[model samples]
Target: FEFIHPEFHEIVRRRLQTIIESRIVLPPVEQRLLRRDGSVVDVEVLALPFETEGGVTLQVTARDITQRRIAEAEREALEAALRQSQKLEAVGTLAGGIAHDFNNILSAIVGNTRLLLEDLSEAHPGWRSVKEIRSATHRARDLVKRLMAFSRQQESQRSAIPLAPLITEVQHMLRATIPAGIELTVRVPPDTPTILADATQIHQVLLNLCTNAWQAMPTNTGRIEISVTTLSEEAARAQSGTPLHGASHYVCIEVRDNGAGMSSETLEHIYEPFFTTKQPGEGSGLGLPVVHGIVQTHKGAIAVTSRPGEGTSFFVYLPACEAPPASFESAQRAVMRGTEQHVLYIDDEEPLVFLVQRTLERAGYRCTGEMNTARAIEIVRQAPDSFDLVITDLNMPGMSGLDVARELLMIRRDLPVVITTGYVRAPDVAAARDLGVRDVILKPDTIDELAMIVQKNLTGNR
Candidate 1:
């Protein structure tokens, strides 16, 4: 009785008394037992009342269940993590669909806007307004791209990027939005190594982390520090408590905030989708989850530490790579024009077909727009050498762009096929390449980009 934990002492006594009075065995109850050495162990206590020659004698058996309890707790945590992962994956699928549809609309707007701008002279009164509209479309395109990245629908275009310049760009962008009261500091050593990462996604990670840090300080007067440093593979493993593979060195980007921190309970769920501590209408609770997804996609790791009052710090570790050679900016040249090459473009969307036909014709190419895949294939089958290039949309009603490409190549082995899509999967891209696809271009291309692609493929084929 004295060895029982203080909180369970009374309950244990009551249960034992009940067992003795009833002269029967009671169900085992879980409780905690305190050792003389001041250590506590979880135990299951079973009390049985046995009638001997005298009165009822109570027999209590305590079994150590400390390890069992720990195992159960770990299993529950894993189940919870699995459920959260499934939920995020479902959300990502839905987000990808929405982004695909939204991108189609953006493509039309961007394409039309480019044509309108081309027709309007600089002296035109509506030119500035049209340019603003174009700018807004560009911003919208970037937003859609971010959504695609979050949904895991966009493939990363990685390059060896110097951390110093990237962080500086983020700092400059942050200064425009963060409150004046919040002190933002950035520190990157000149010798910091470069990291092989998608610059845009990495930028997004920093922006989200910094934004989250600033929001944590509701007082509006706090300090947020961003620092970059290099870590050895063993040091990274030790710091994060997780084994890292592949890269020998890692670049650690730490975002620390001196603000109201989070409790241990809150920390466990910070990465869960739609989990936020912000007030109503203040946040969508997606920043951290997106940050988590992006970092994981980059083959990086995030380690966070926080306490109720001692602020929080997020350490992001990305594999470092060798410094890339110096890059030079190329001079802007005029849009490449086609040499009246016969081109056949197919899409389910009639408006997109018309837009492409007109856009290509204006670029000195003879264009034929067909909305039906079957009809387009028939036209090519009838005259294989009539068209020099075939441009098709990826996600059509019946036969996809890859199917069309395969069929066209069967008829004309030397035909160049270009696939355009609002959204594409990695498998589809690989399949297209296997079918000898000239290029796979994403939707909402500018007038110049479309022209250049057409001309480049035509020239390559010739």
Candidate 2:
């Protein structure tokens, strides 16, 4: 019989001849067969030798199985996708746990560092070391934020923001981080529409892409350009293969680098978390994945193109907004010094309780620290009107900060209670606000930020 795939004919013929010579039947085997129409079809073939009046004759049976083969392939693809999702979920859970514990520890260190710096003058020899330590802590906090972002635990604070100013700020920051050999350039048109997004998350996305572009060059020598332009949905899809968005228009932010590019194989797995091509200890492999998560959070899409020596470009498309960008004038905040106002602070971690108590005392607030939630409640119950503000860690044994805050508010309806947590969630914040909690603060905050929150809450300032 003729085969569409002629290459397999000889092999099939050899097997059939052996079966005929042995006068035996062979079990069915799967193979690809060619049809008269020059189309290939999957089939199961069996060969047998039969006695007939015209002497020994070969009989062959073929069963078409194209649909079955296709079904099997689809099943395998689905299984692979499910396995990948499970693996990512496991890693994300672990990352969230690590970030929570690490943030608490960093908060104590950071708060104390601030206090030390306040006592020492700029000329003091230890002052520089302390400042360096503070900077390192800030970097660590940034890593935690990235981890949370990748895990989908971090919440975005969206607002109407102009693309130009944000890019300009990032360019200024990158100047100090990028190698001297790498030139950074930013081009933004004045007419680009504003986008409603989390500025910090968007900043992280740009920083990561630019940093990767810089690192792609072997000698850190390359020109990295970030440009923004407006495009319609159809235009965006045509230019960058970006999906058609619900919005009428999109702002395309392109980060292009004329450095060593990635191969097709490398590009395929670049966005996978923990998948890295760099040398060990050089990267966490979470950068691009984090960027992808951030873009997704902002209801945006990212497309990447690359060739071995032609360099790479990352195209990020964000929905355009017609509303004017919100003004962000920096207003100087007075460092609110605590009066004789009394505060109650509770945390399961005794070290954290001690750290906050000391920090608050130094800021002229009388702080009562408690490691036990039950005791904290008893203290509030014993003298409900004594404390002006109650600050408690959210996650704790027995009773959560939410539970404690509820009980405290019941005793004193006007009590300014602030809930603190390592991880920030929008829903949780909204829920806390509904419960009459004065404010929700993220952990590992600077002493000044913590003080400001406390003062704002106590002074009835939102």
lDDT tens digits, residue span 1-462, model 1: 678889997898787777777777878999999899989999998877778999888777889998998899889867765776687789878877676567778878877888898899999999999999988886777666666776677777677889887788789878999899999999999988889988779989999999998888888889999998899999998897767878999989999998899999999999986678998568767789888888887788999999987899999999999867235212114556778889999988877888888888888899999999999999999989999988898888889889999999999898999998876668878998989998887777533367777777878942
The lDDT, on a scale of 0 to 1, for candidate 2 is 0.83
Q: Which stretches of candidate 2 lie over 4 Å from their true place?
A: 4-11, 158-200, 207-223, 227-252, 258-333, 446-448
Clashing pairs in 2: 4-34
TM-score for candidate 1, residues paired by index: 0.77
Q: lDDT values of the candidates?
A: 0.84, 0.83
Please state every model's RMSD to the true fold in angstroms: 6.0, 6.1
How would you encode candidate 2's per-residue C-alpha lDDT over 1-462 as one tens digit per residue?
577267777778778778877887777888888887888888898877888998778777889998998899889856766776687789887887787788898998888888898799999999999999988887777668766765677776577899887789789879998899999989999889999887778888999999899999998888999999999878977886656677888899999999999999999999987678898668767789989887886778899989999899999999888888764223114556889789889889888888788888877899999998998899988999899989998888899888998888888899888888888767778889999997777778634367776777888987
Model 1 residue runs over 4 Å out of place are 159-197, 215-220, 225-256, 260-332, 446-448
